[model samples]
Target: MDIRQLSYFVAVYEQGSVSAAARLCCVAQPSLSAALRQLEQELGVTLFARLPKGVTPTEDGEKLYGHAGRLLSQLQSLKASFSQPVARVKFRLGLIRALGVERMSQLLREFSNNVQGLELHLVEPDEHCDARIITPQLLKAGEAFQPFWHDSYLLAMPPGTPLSLQAEVHLADFEQLPLIKRTPCDAWNTLYPELVRRGIKADVRADIQTIEYALGLVSAGVGCALVPNFDTLLQRQDIVLRPIVQLKLERQLGLAYRKNQTSASLTVLRQLCQPVP
Candidate 1:
């Protein structure tokens, strides 16, 4: 009946679960559920058939999905027309910030050329996205993930630092190591417990957010930081990268979406993301 309800319906239909849709929409699960219930009451039809794992579209739900998708697309196009003469198909994608600058830049360039009229929005922490290119660790329940290109985390420090002579670093090497804390990183958090268990306390120097800043701090000799191996970093003479023998944190980057749900633009992206030989 209303735009909000229609949007909620579309999210639930695509996500196949109210909880998953709530996360994608950055809303509380209860609020999203209440909206769907109210919409179902107003329309006099059940939109979804609930299951133990997740929800599936009912016959009525499938019918509404078509109309709602088109309607939302039109509204988005209308909004875009004011900014640019040509209205583009919007595709909101969630990208993890930990993925370094080189990879992100390359992906954007490659994707734009492949998908025409692609209005890509990199929504993170707050995932208001049709599809997400995040690691498996961050994926929602029941979402099918197709792994693409990715890399591992490494100990990044300025040249001639204390442990630079060692070809392979270990948890024991971290004692007295000054570290930049990149907060709210799931991968970093996973490595934290192991460091604690090994009695390797990070000589906390900088508490930063973005990976770019973390790298910048590393370059400045402020402190060493754990950064993804890929980056314009490989080429940078200022920084040296060494693998942690004990904890090799490799990121499984991929296309995460509901299989068969086929978000219009993301369906094409899914095909493009197939692991190549």
Candidate 2:
């Protein structure tokens, strides 16, 4: 019925007797017993079977014990979020492979330095999911998430692969080479249709996991790859990246948390990942 009742119920279940629960709760035995009795009355179910040796939880009591434990844990977390200092706020950030580890790491370091109470957890979903880490459904649901950047995809090739010197690479030319395709997703649906229009079939040479792995294969002359234009990879001498003309490939990057909750720590993180004008 209430947090206190749940706490008392859990304590009795753990200690196996009201007297023991009272000692653990720092309350009188009679008070603990009364709380348990009141809880059972409110719920209209017998909770524990009384015995001389100890009280054992009945079927209903066992079920309530599990639910009450979870409820109390969540309550404790909620209490901590408000009562604890700002530096204790926990964050979970999801990223695609193309965001570039070096760039993301730098952003995280800067954020940590600026925000005292911040704890950030970063996840790369490319290893598991076929879709881009950030989906339209996730955004449209008005989920407590915000997009920071949507990077246009680039073509990575071995040095001197002779891609056109144009500002953007056309899908027609992509058909001419052995393409190392990233996994198929709705994000690239437009580009795939354009490829079909041009009468060019993608010669998918490999289906690699992450952009880095695909780039490694590209650098080794396995096949060309489409990747994010993270400046760190551009510095590598063995690989050359050109803007993919006409393909217009891009991936969105963002942060998510529970809605309507303002977090100073999250704001600091967003500033770190802000794109330069």
Candidate 3:
């Protein structure tokens, strides 16, 4: 019904338990529970299903989560508009979808530790942010780009599969295998056509939008996909990752910000992201 109640609801939905959400909000458990009950009563819908271990969102809760996230974000921006002038620096950072949520969280934790008096906001690609962690493909004119790192693509196969035994898989190996396709790989866009022109075949059995989805299909024995050697994906025990020595492909990752604008937080981030000599 109110901002506080909605905050409590969002925390509960995200954290999955009243106790956990209470710890996150720095509020009492009973008070947080009372707020959820009040919200449910007002909405006349059960938002979450109470379970022995924790809670799971109901269908209605899932629907409410999207709206609540936007509402809270806007509210924070509105408050920041007035308070930000005199308060500690509030910085917004945009991350591309290729960097999964877990990776983003890890980066945020590191940034929080390194910077003082910084209130960091994680944003999507479309939103206006102080700076963004993005691929070179998304860079625009007048935006200053700083190369951060490179992520190489690797062949991802289901565990114990015949191809998993190979120390290094060649591009020719893909000719005989059913490949799972993940969209928006700049490297693949160029490589696929060139492969076809050179008499190599990529038998794409499935097309997926995200690396996670492609990895899931690979784990299910659906087919193999070319996935980025991201930390979380590389650590997955369900799939086997092998280097593609025949065709080396990688995309450069970077931080981009407007050239003329200067901010304390942005300066700090630039200093931190400076490449080692």
TM-score of 1: 0.63
User: How many pairs collide in each candidate, listed in order?
Assistant: 0, 5, 0
**Global lDDT scores for all candidate models:** 0.78, 0.68, 0.80
Judging by lDDT against the true structure, name the best candidate: 3
Q: Candidate 2 residues 1-277, lDDT tens each?
A: 7888898888777666678678767899888888888999999999988776567778999899889989888986797778846636566666544556645544665676687666666666433321123543445333455566667767778876677355556677766677787764333465667787879887788886677688789988888887776644555567777786555667666665446556576566655655455
Candidate 1 lDDT at 61 equals 95
lDDT string for model 1 (1-277, tens) is 7999898898777666688689867899999999999999998999988776577778899899999989998997787678656458888778766665534554565576577677887787346677788778788876888898767788898889878888988888778789898976665787888889878887889899988888899989998888777634554567899888867576678888766566556767777777745
Query: Candidate 2, TM-score vs. the true structure?
Result: 0.56
TM-score of each: 0.63, 0.56, 0.63
RMSD in order of candidates = 19.5, 20.5, 8.5
Off by over 4 Å in 3: 1-89, 100-103, 113-119
Q: Looking at model 2, which ten-residue stretch has the lowest summed lDDT?
A: 126-135
- The lDDT-based order of candidates, best leading, equals 3, 1, 2
